[model samples]
Target chain A: MSGVRKLVLLGTGLIGGSFALALKRARLVQHVVGVGRNATNLERALDLNVIDEASHDAAAAVAGADLVLLGTPVGQMGALMQQIAPVLAADCIVTDGGSTKQDVSALFRQHLPRHLSHCVPGHPIAGSDLSGAAAAQYGLFEGRRVVLTPFAETAQNALEQVQTLWQQCGARVYTMTPEQHDGIFAAVSHVPHLLAFAYMNAVLAKVDAQPCLDFAATGFRDFTRIAGSHPEMWRDIAVANREAILADLKACASQLQHVIALVEAGNTEGMEDYFATASRARVAWGQRHK
Target chain B: MSGVRKLVLLGTGLIGGSFALALKRARLVQHVVGVGRNATNLERALDLNVIDEASHDAAAAVAGADLVLLGTPVGQMGALMQQIAPVLAADCIVTDGGSTKQDVSALFRQHLPRHLSHCVPGHPIAGSDLSGAAAAQYGLFEGRRVVLTPFAETAQNALEQVQTLWQQCGARVYTMTPEQHDGIFAAVSHVPHLLAFAYMNAVLAKVDAQPCLDFAATGFRDFTRIAGSHPEMWRDIAVANREAILADLKACASQLQHVIALVEAGNTEGMEDYFATASRARVAWGQRHK
Candidate 1:
């Protein structure tokens, strides 16, 4: 109710660092504290003015904070919830910047006290291929969509406060169930990433057989650029959201099979028709959104 | 034996127009002539200074040019070659900016005069989702790779001249057989585009059921951006390089099957190992090249 005076951003990497920069630019909170496993990264966050102070102790960082934003990998959120549970204030709000929502929400429910209905799961759908505090920018969230998945028992006030924070940072907020969030992202975001990674892997596996790397063009670079993301981070994402990711993989494989069959069967007309429809739909979608 | 003085660029879209710009910036040609079906785009090319003049007549554009660059869709290259062959000078070096090399080379062999050993088939492995002369920039080819697939009968002096031209325009040139060129690109470029297009189509098909587009992020946008490229152009590429594209698709499908089996079997160790290997290899490859 005191307008979220003090904020602790746990795991001040790209997401958390960007959030801190946004908060500072908007002058939304009194103090911003950063917590991370690496002291060097924490120091870099402080040096870059992403936060007012840096601390390695999660408990100490969240001690008096009104908002604790968990910005760690999806697989690490559960253990972090337990570590910060005892130190979080009675009325403090807990939110996250993780990609998956189902697992994060479950972690909160299992670790945090039930009376602490301030847990609100949020994901700001904005990032670049670059990572860490050095890659953070002030307007990273501008004109981006941030989804908030609140449990049924979540405090109404806490949810509104979290929404306000995102809005002030220039993000359009959408509310959905955790399952729906994961499913949608699996189709649009997670699956696309996995596909890119898989594509690069397939090519690199044969790097010695052909001059694939030497002959790579701008198209290859752009398509596989994100494949260069943090391996540990992506591995966690793949495992944590295994079910939804597999569902997407199934859909993708079936689509690939259909195209392959059309080509193999010499169904030129059908193949052309398929590409035409996809091209038209995608072009229309891009024009509208861009 | 003299340096190229006049350059004629056919189908002055993104690649053609960009080539024109690069030639002008490098001062490699005295005049740049643009040929296209669309008068409006030709005018845009002239206004943007990508070309010194615009001509709708293919024969007139190639009449006295020292070099002619075909920049149309792969499907249209054959017709354009036939149209320009009669008027092209005996000494004029005709090359192409098409994606697939084997088919384009076949067209040149069929239509080009026997005296014109000057005809060399080429593909500049650079482009963006943007199209038309309006999207052209002078630095488009800087630091990009250009593949030149010369036939056995190709004049040695003419091949060297073409290589020098691309080098002057700030591109790294490499030589390969048309088959090797198509096969390598199918894995690194064509198949990736097909996968992106197919994946986007899959997501769009489910829009009615789930509205996944509403929550799409940068990852999805980047992955599917190529899907929005000219449908007719991609359609031509898919058909022209059918064999290599099919091979790449089969390989990708098998890789997806491995991932699918792991997920279905709930083999966490296998899944982790697969993703970790993919992520690590992709990251290393991306960093080295990108």
Candidate 2:
């Protein structure tokens, strides 16, 4: 397949900028345009060669572009889709690097109904605590997984083109329904962030919170590291993936209650069995993941 | 002050072996005898020079020893204390490397009533997933915190000797009552381990648990890292620190319920504030810790 003639990035932050940089390294896109509200970040992207041009107007930036990536937070993606709907080229393969799929899918249907055939919703599973154009790097997606959730009306060619582009950036691409993508991510990514935040809040609630934190060691550090995630970003995720998040949170709460009962009863044997199940599975996961 | 003439390590493992190694590095101990049920592990400790002598009998090993460190699990510490009580030297300083303190303090009182004045219980904050004599290292306690929970009857001279030994091993030492130590650790270390174990168990309860584990990334890895901890050891902790662990687990459960309510009601602003509170504190902690 031939390279993209022009590619526009809806948000010039880590995810979008990294995508542009990777595409540039792979020589899969001729010219890249980064659009964002942050002037300094856009300028930095240009200076760093993450994009060939920078634009403040999303609508103007997507005109005549063969590819557009919605890399903004889920809260901002609807308005972005609305902005580009009237200006996006007929054959442009529109996709996103959103964490959740269902909300982005609805946005696509609501704002870009006429362009549904060319629209694709995807999630690149390369999350980080860092952000901004400056945090972008060429190998961000290398050996990563990207899931594309295509609507029924989405053209096969458009879906394949998006998948191929991610593959060019050294990602392994998988296709799943939007619901599947949302459910899987809710279990793995979204729920863990929420749990970490909840655990942190619980720690903060202690009367001896400062001393508790002072004495916290490596175990506490690793367990609550994700609690330091971006607030508004995670908030949007909680709302967007509410149902799945709620289910997982409830499950975790139930698990915690069971643990309390075991400890309350001083049931060492039961606690051992409970912890052993988790420990075995976690050890197996580490072996596989590493 | 002066070095220990002879040090006896009961149930020699990672903690015991590392302590012996660090003391040797500081030239603060004349002789180290490692005692354990496992003959192979004892032999390994001797081979690694973590111990100058290997003994199968805790009682025999403590005979005429000036210092005896009960570096075993809380479960085994009671029996070892019983075994050594009859033979321990009059001025010998007995301490432990137990994670939970109150129970270890009780064990000392129950078995070594006459030796209470010379007993000082401590917890070294340098925890690792690795275990056994082979995991021992010279600098394991370097820059680490060692909390010593002394009995009211504990002699200042005995406490100072243990504190000075840890300081010589490159550790910062703090003193507290066993109750305070247990409460702080339950909030920080023990509860987090239980929570991670609960979270992992929750994931395992899912019908599609394998798929979820397959997609588990860095956040899941870090958040549930403690879930891979030794089950029997954690079970012992859960029993030993039951009251504190239960209190914190309940608090955590309540926090999760609040999060569930926020997401269920689509209260994005409320969720944002909740996440922001945790995110800010966690970020501040990372800055301080680094």
Candidate 3:
């Protein structure tokens, strides 16, 4: 812990930039170096004070850093890991800020060096609709949940170090299996995004549709906000976690069918009861969580 | 407009309560008299300064007020209007905070006295998941939309007065027909709520479901928060606006079927394009609106 001075952040977009800022705010990292494909974005990160320095060279950026954090889209993790694997120091700890965990873990296991016992896969359940380094802000992870899914072979010391870092960033860390993390997120996050995307597409496809954009109230905005996220990133998430996403979709489909049947049958009381229960559950959960 | 002093706010819950607070904050209304069934809520309204006074008698509340605003659930508006119809002054302006417009308009035409030419039916396109007078807060209407659906018979002066009042309360007002308002809201608000309710219900009904609540992330929380809204209110909105609600549901259903077909056919490219277009449209719409 005493020797952990330099930190290298891969993909200096929202997540990476936020991580860099949080670390700096907490004074956990002595120097934060940002790595990204976009040189302009790296410069913007510097201007925004998201990182101490910007570097386009991935391998060189990870060369002597004590901690390396991957904040790339889920799809790019494999290639980025492979590119940095050769240059990464054996004792340097690596973590991620991806949405899905299973694929990222698989990629690390496949590409990362055997001596890199410090490679720990993680996902912070924190984000916004805004993208890029400019959207980053200090304390973005404060009071947010950060889930770390470590493999059985992952070194205890490495896990502890990553967990401690997230704690210092003001995130409450939870540990779960990669499978559990994927399944839960599919039900809660991925499926919701899919539904929003699908719904928006449907609304748009209607030729004579009214000006939905003009008439869209706050409810519509809130429901569709996640639909505005990076399509390629979401596409990767959908394909990578296909089975779990499908399961959640099927569950949603069945529920919709049930409600449709009741509506068709004129079962007003039944429909009311169903909605009432959902409303009560949501209110209670929100109150308790908030 | 100068003589419009006393304001009677019926059903002092979320919309009505917030309106009262906004009016008081802006000093637009000299006195806001709240009328509702719940004595505790009415007392809380007075205690929280959402209303200047409380009255259990709807007729008494409307007797001296220059502006009468119905803030009850849409289904209850007709009955409440009937209860106060005889006591309503000829010169008083009557409006509503209901979501759907057609039923309320029909109810007003039927039950309201013909001498009361000042009846202007309106729907404030803003609210939160929280209900009751205690949840009311100032600035709820800031930069939000309020739709006023005035019939041909509606008095022009009355409409202008109501529009000015809403403007003073910090809302941009739009004009539309009752049918148009209902149709647009069905697509934007009612259908979205149904989807949320149906989605959450489906997750809960899963036979081998994991602990979804424990793992529910911000996405789930945001998407389902409206599901926790007042069941009775939503039930009323859905049933009263059944035709438009069904139309919106069919639209969403057709879109879902298309996605399912593409997924089943292994048309990955088509699915990706579908999602991408939707994502792009939503991102553009959100940016503009925000």
In order, the B-chain TM-scores come to 0.96, 0.97, 0.96
Cα lDDT for residue B126, candidate 1: 82
TM values, all candidates: 0.92, 0.95, 0.92
Task: Give all candidates' CA lDDT scores.
Answer: 0.81, 0.91, 0.83
- Model 2 chain B — which ten-residue stretch has the worst lDDT? B126-135
Q: Which ten residues in a row have the lowest lDDT in candidate 1 chain A?
A: A204-213
Q: Write the per-residue lDDT of candidate 1 for residues A249-272, one digit (tens) a residue.
A: 988899999989877776767777
lDDT for residue B46 in candidate 3, whole number 0-100:
92
Poorly placed runs, candidate 3 (over 4 Å): A113-116, A207-210, B25-31, B113-116, B206-211, B259-272
Q: Put down candidate 3 lDDT per residue, A156-271, tens digits, no spaces.
A: 99999999888888999999998988988888888888888878886786643556578787888888888777776777787778788887787787777777676666677888
Per-chain TM-score (chain B), model 2: 0.97
For A219-273, candidate 2 gives per-residue lDDT tens digits of: 9999999999889889889889889988988888889889998899888889999
Candidate maximizing DockQ: 2
Model 3 chain A: ten consecutive residues of lowest lDDT = A204-213
Q: Which wins on lDDT, candidate 1 or candidate 2?
A: 2
Candidate 2, chain A: TM-score against the reference: 0.97
Give the candidate number with the greatest TM-score.
Answer: 2
